[model samples]
Target: MADTFLKEQVRARSIGDWIALPVLIAVIFAAPFFPAVLTSVPNWAILPVSDWVGEGLNWLARDAGVGGVTFADVTRALAAAAEAPIDWLKIVLAEGWVTGAGFNKVQAAPPLSWLGVTLAVALVALRLSGRGLMLLTLVSGLYLALFGLWVLAMTTLASVLLCVVTALVLGLAIGIRAYRSPRTEAFVRAVMNVMQTVPIFSYLLPTLLLFGYGPSAALFATVVYALPPMVHATVLALRSVPQETLELARMTGCSRAQTLWKVELPVAVPRLAIGLNQVVMMTLNMVIIASMIGAGGLGYDVLRALRRLDFGAGFEAGMGIVALAVVLDRLTQAAAHNQSTQAVGLWRRRDTVLALALLIIFTLFSFVIPSLGLWPKDLTLTTAPFWNGAVSFINREFYDPLDAIRTAMLLKVMNPFRDLLLATPWTLIGLLVCFAGYALGGKRAALTVMALLLFIALTGYWEPAMVSVYLTTLAVAIALAIGLPFGIWVSSRPRFHQPVQLVLDTLQTLPTLVYLLPAVMLFRNGDFSALIAVVSYAVAPAVRYGMAGMKHVPSERVEAAAMSGCTPWQTFRFVRLPSAMPTLLLGVNQTVMMALSMLVIAALVGTRELGQEVYTSLTRGEVGPGIVAGLCVACIALIADTLLKSAAARAARHEGDIHA
Candidate 1:
């Protein structure tokens, strides 16, 4: 009887809250139209968060000292320390180091002949995976050389290697420490969360400030950007080790270091290998963006092409990046999954010896035939003219239709949505967000979003924040509109699946900078170009999740639907879509995050959003403004992530209840 009474009270309260929700929303929406006193955040209430951050940075730059060294001095010294190895690597890989009397280019001397490098890569691939990857590596090397991009690709690869090594070392140390201490784990996790969410562009300026610009600064930014994933992956892998296994190590009188080396690390290899894969991918992703600060390579080639509107050249450079990414991705994945014995008798090590012997022979041959050491310039091919011609043809033939579509999208959809978002009072928007938070995750979430909104407002970037939200919202909406149905259609067809997935993979993995100019060429610079690029970039996840969810649906449920005599559309709409909704929402959350991440890049195409603010601050070296704007972006991402995650959780719970 007491339980029944409590249930009744709870039900009554739920009804009351439901009744009040509409009223609350109505007041918020109507208040904006009524009076500023009721709806708008007061002008006086806007705090100078950026100014405060600037002042802090200035103080550190001025008065902060340790061991008789000022902050700036310390930063410069650290920069100098980091630069030394990078310089050595740069020279060895592409720039040729100095010898007895003068300098010689690596390309001119060729450390390992083109044949040796190609053959060595093939052998590594063969050892790592099998014949297929060996062929792939051979093709990749030939492609780089044939296209006259070998040196440039190698230059990028050199920087990426340095960055990856540094990130891995630091990430592992931190991750291991966190794994051993709860307090350390908590602190690391908090920092990792911030680092992961903060956009890459935000890291650039502060790194430049401290490192004083160059490839080294770019490398520093890349390390900071890519380190979080490695740390998280390491922590996860370590924590996943069974307690029984660990306890056994303890029972055997293993010291902590001994246990970590002999037991934990061996067990953690597969997981760490996955982390290494992530580190490689992220390192590659940063290659192009890092170029903006003078970390030259294939990225510089692409950037130059974009500035010149040379679609052919840009496309070629972009393809080189894709090729490099594919090779690394495959190699790392193979390494992660490999479980071969490394210890063997010398009699069985003939293949390794033979490979090394071939390399040495090729090196000797290169001295006699220098052209073999480096790809002959006369033998290289250029596909840029072909690509340029194609671009020109498309522009001539489809210009009008493309222009109309671009204009219609801007005039009919994007502009109005943006204006509505920008014009809405912060109070109304905050209330709406709070309501959403409350509905999705109760009072705690509501409070969290309220705090996020208040913080954004205090930063004096409210309107820019709204602009980013507006762009992300529209981009995600369009992404879902296109990607969802495509995913559904493709999921039902086996033959189409792999091909579609391959394209999507390329779209997702291709660097963000690759699309900057292609977008401009198609849509011209404006919100349209930015939105187009963002949608293109963000849509892949939605489709990926949709297809995955559908593919994983229970066969029994599907068969039952067929037995019910439902039409294909009806079955999909009623059964499949419902099952996939949770996963789709998770994809949408990813899509939103991707769009926000692209915001700063989009600013290059002329979108005057928070991205532009961050970009402007970055260019002007205004650390305080740049950092605060970045935090605002992070705040926006956190809110969206939280609400969507809560919704996904609720959906999952509902499904579980139904299953039970």
Candidate 2:
């Protein structure tokens, strides 16, 4: 049966497939004979693109300009304007307003009382959602206050709020424009693809050069990082608006603008809210990374803790970020889904009036009772000693087993895979990718994949790129192995679904930085640690997508399989799995992207990959190398994304054929 199936498969191939097979095979066999030519791109062929790009950017920053003003001057002016609001918000949230510099300064007013802010947030949550969210808001706010993270948390909150607002406005405008013009949409889609695939670190390099080092650069980076998702969400939401709604608007003699504002936008609100949630989460994520550029907040504290090897301090700050993320996520989600009817006048609304009254009352009381303004330092708590003790005990008691597992994994699995990838000839790999692309997609995909790979090779980053690929590939495999089964089990057991989903959601919500802390604490610095961090960070998508796929499988198909005398395992293997293959492949794509993203952060734990290259370039102020390394990482992500999407498409088609 196997031989017959193999023969039939060979017989089904087109002439092009047959021709391509031998060419791929020949390239693989010929690689060893011409190692110098095939194994790597030689010096003569390597392009100095990074240097050229660096020079061009420097000129744009320093020399190139129109009229009397240089580009740097314009950017500085804009930065100054943007900085004004941020500085004001900082004062309002944490740093009380002052009239003068140094010892000569006089306090104009204390910032909003922590008591007031907490009450206001709770009121808003109650008004938009219900008692559950209100309680959650109160608890999260209290956690920050009690842990002595109020000031830093507030500072981070200010930055996040500003960035989210900015990103939303810009994303809406751009998305609306793209919706109106197909050409514009196509162009914007291409740009968004690059923006989404490019590692977050790449964004800081250009922002740093243009805006200089400060909150301005961090603000700009945060906005850019968070902008793409909002734009995507806006476009998708607008496109998905019901056709019946549009027709009704036309029948009612509505103008285009009126149709959009009065009909489409209201309908799109729920979906757009999801985008808002994404923007909020992404802004928080970037804010932490932006701390490296002087955007001080909880992220700065976390960074400082990491540097000092103070695990306790880092955990506290990281939890502060999680608390903030949860609050914002819930508030925004509730606000979007809010369906309560409002009175004619805003002042007539009981909840709104009460919330405002609470804000005013608390702020007024803060002037006489100063403790209400900010959580008193002496009243705060610390878990640093407890955490330190726990870490010491674990290390002292469980060191051998943990070290043994790490060593075994590295020696037996990771190193061998890394060596194989590094030893593989670039030419053979390139051809293999081309053939795979052609087989999965077509000529366009083939050309695109080959070109992207070629660009990486020509830039002289192939070796490190291979290292990155090895780490990501292994991490993704492990994540899928673990997540897929768990997701399947949860999907099969109805009672487990909600709890498992909540766990996955929380994992995804935590910033990538937090994953590094535990991994580094346990495994120290190496591929093993990086692998653990990447897997923990990337596993959520796998579980989420897999569970979704399994849960969505048609009940009719499962019933039919069972009725045909199949056992439960046979029904799943033959019926449910095939039906879910396309979605599972999509899950794989997401897992790969998430893994690649975490790998960059894992560089901090001393992995020698493209992430390290980018980090090195950032620290050394080498724009050219940083940009090149970032692009290489982006290429790897795009390649994986494209191939997996193609495979998913093929699976869907095959499934459809089987159904027919």
Candidate 3:
């Protein structure tokens, strides 16, 4: 009886209940004065793999002759073949195709004129959305032309188009295969989680090796970065299709291919549209970053402005990026939901055909009037000076206050937090993670967490990893502080919704590089500037999710609280906030992920973290260091994500229990 009772007691205890006290004691005793080996990764234990990777890359760069057939010859041949379409697209869209030799070289011109492009885009927008979107599309094109950004904008557009198409096609193919095979799906999910978590910067080095530096390498990296979202979204959409519907299709004698193409795909269009939207946003986000790897476009312009400290030029390029992101986002979103609306006439439904017809006419007319083929140089305008002056005026007027805020934040918040994180021994941190993981997800998660932590430590990146963790944690805390209040205020007022959402959308979609310039302008370089840039990029999701959660609170619950004579604050605290807590937690997850993604970009402004390690590795063409540091960041993200998801699940269960 005593043996059974002991077994019962052990089984009844939660992981945390059983282990928390012991782990807490261990941390207290070991954290502050731990041995150097326990506190950090020792130099002798460092991986020698980086040197091997460097040697391998050098070997690949050199010519290897096999009976006069050199490796360089093969790579060059393949690269040129792959680049053919990209080169053609860029020239056709931006410079028009040229035909004829040497001195006789003359523009054969693209089939579509600037006028045609504008008209076609507007028509497509009209078909997808309505007159409002159509007008927005027209204005966006005019802005590009009038600002003398048409060529650069078109270059960026062509790159994005190629990347998006390739990513979507590839993602769909993989997603479909994964959907068909449960094992494949599981493996793909694991790979995607890592891929999505890895910083975009980490992708550049290996791609630079395989494709060499230029638009081709950048294109390859962008596709890889953007592909996961599409694949995940496609999987989700396909899986979401009613099993009954699929069964019915199968019963009707549909072959596997037929069921997929004729039944599943049609129904999956809306969900696939969501994936496409993600692909577009991700593609545009990478546009500027890719420029760093020799994929020039408007991103090149933004990079130049960053180096020169020209806010005006940066702002212009930034706006152009925002414009492109907004247009793509709107169009793709509209496309996703378009099928649900009432059907219209052929002219409306076949808008693509109409747009094509108009494009042909406009192109033909442009042959008669050559200026229509390109945006006229004499008509271009630039507002860089105005933006520069505005930034200057703001800096002069608010210098003291901004400086004070920056200084206090560095001294009071960032520095202490970073030092504390750095000083904490890895063993203690690992133990804490193990306990948390076990509490959240049982033995598998605990082991998984420990293994990843051990891997990071063994890579000799433990300190930099801690620095990244500190940066992410502090930035997220600040984002919540600001984002929650603002989100609450905006959510409470219906009148503020659209404008606030628009601004948030822009903030979310704007390139990471754009945030850097403003950070430099305001805080200069340091942890502070890095903090500002990260917060700017990350805060939007927090605000968005908070507002969305509040807005989604059950109406009846609010009414019940009111009837119970609760004050507004009391009602919000007792009713709305608790109900919305799960979603708000989800928002926090997104915010942390976003902040981690910015770590590499933050390093550019002198924030010492794993991101700096990754960036340094990239510049030196050292693959192992970049990858090891990236994995550390991914591990942090994975740990945080698992904990938060567990917490949210627990909250949901508790609420369900209370209701029961």
Candidate 4:
């Protein structure tokens, strides 16, 4: 039967189909050889995302549609934006009032005698998470006050408060909706995928337009950018609420709303708090980034320090951001943990107390020493010399040679592969997906892939979508190469698995900005750099799940393999690997989604795919195009996720029977 099945597969295609595929591929290969292929002619024009990137460069160099750079006009705008924040800040610090001529930005809290603010905050901390959290919160406040950053910290805090509260409300509401309705769940998940996959850098331009400048825009951007995690957590929390508990609630003859409010929501609170915690941390992080668009406070200070090449101030500010991230992170985590364990005590209440104490200390310092959060007039610290010098050194030293490799690969390898990918007929690809999905999972899986692919086509970004698909395919291949073996090796040894898991966590948490651009310098642009960046970010889940699946190999199965005089390789291959294959497949599925996400983010380093279009659309102020491309990306994630999850379920059910 196996031999007949193999023969049937070999004879599945007609000669003409095979011949036409290659010819079609070759035609795509030759088209790009024409210089004007990407540009427009008189009547018709083909402007790929790559073309838009070139145009953006020209726009920056030339005056674009505007007249020459009017220094006075530019200066007037900057001078105005610059003056408002400082003036508002001074008032807030001095009179505890920010109300101005047209802006009734009345400071909310009555200027707490800095001392009073501290006591109030400390007391609040004492109520929430316990003594340890209270102490940490107190120290944070004291540090801010002593450093004279009290006023700035308060400004930051006020902003954090508003954005996070809004995020929590929206996230919780949507999350619950997602859990209850299939359509809403699909829509919400789709939106979440796009928000997560799109780069922060890509959205900033559009955010600038909508928010209409300053703190208002920044706050709006903050809320939008950070809302997804909260929503996702809320949904997951609700979904994971024990089935027995829900049954019990229903059995109580309670009305649906009553059951939800008194039973379901309370039961789900522990997990739902995770979403709130995530929202808080995310909101805080975005606030620091908000400075880019004139949201005042420490973020702007860091931005200025970076522009001026002041490494010291930049470093200090960066630390401050990190400290802030940690404090918020700790508080949220404590709250979530305490709630989850249903633990109640003085210690558990500390996080709230700590937060309040820090607030007070912050207020006191704001009115006293001004420099804590303020940059000195000379603005002595900068990183320009270092960054510029390093950039120059790398470009001249290592990147040049690396670029040569990129050039060679693009001309020879990727260019050829690009053609091969395009040559795949939509119909044949559909059949292939259907067959693969059916073989691994079932009818539902086949339909899922069809829907995903159909969405990509209907979006009117089919060609660029194919390019993205090709790049993601290549990335997944590379990711599997690195992640699988490591996963298998670590899983085999009990001692090493824990350590490997720790490494995976670290890789997952490191911000994309830290390594993504540099990775481009290493591999250069196009599919290669995008591939590496995607591989770096997406590979973690693959390894983690692979390890998990393998380590779960039944003890009896392992023993049986040993009894058969199996070598280590034989044991893993014949017993462990087969057993873990299902989980490993799920890992690959996650890796696919993650690869797409990173591909979008890596557009910063120049990827000639849908992400580039998303980038271009934002710059051109074309929201429709950007969102269209974003939907395509989301479709790809959902497709892979659905099919793989189905397969994992099937495989996990096979029990301890070793195929070998």
Identify the candidate with maximal TM-score: 2
Backbone collisions counted per model: 0, 0, 0, 29
How far is 83's C-alpha from truth in model 1 (Å)?
2.2
lDDT value for model 2: 0.88
lDDT of 1 by residue, 291-345 (tens): 8897899988987888788878888888888888878878877766663233233
Model 3, 1-660: lDDT tens digits are: 997996785586554466576767867775668788887778888776656656776676575558888776676666667688789888867877789989999977663677788889888888778899899889888888788887888899989999999999999999999998999999999999999999888898777776788887888899999999999989998998899999999899999999999889878888998899899999998988899888888999988998898888988888888888899989878876766343455145467677888778877777888667777798778988887787788799999999999999889988898888887777888888888777766677788889888878877778888888888888899999999879988898999999999899989888888888878887788988888889889999999998998998889889998999999999989888888888888999999999999867888888889899888888888886787688788988988888788777867766666666
Instruction: Give me the candidate number with maximum lDDT.
Output: 2
Candidate rank order under lDDT: 2, 3, 1, 4
TM-score of 3: 0.93
**Cα-based TM-score, every candidate:** 0.92, 0.95, 0.93, 0.68
Error of 2 at 287 (Å): 0.8
Better of 1 and 3 by lDDT: 3
Winner of 2 and 3 under TM-score: 2
Local accuracy of candidate 2 as per-residue lDDT tens digits, 1-660 = 997995676566566788888888887777778758777789988999899888988898899778989999988887888899899899989887889888999878888778888988887877677798889889988989888898899899889989999999999999989888999999998888778878888888888898898887899999999999899998999999989989999999999999989888888988899999999988888877899998999989888887777888888898889889988998877766663232223222777778777777887788889788877889999998898788878888999999999999999999999999999888888888889998898788899999999999999999999999999999999999998888888887888887887687678778788788778887898999999999999999999988988977889999898889999999989889999999999999999999998899888889999999998889888888898899999999989988999999989988887987
- Candidate lDDT values, in order: 0.83, 0.88, 0.84, 0.66
RMSD of each: 3.2, 3.7, 3.3, 9.4
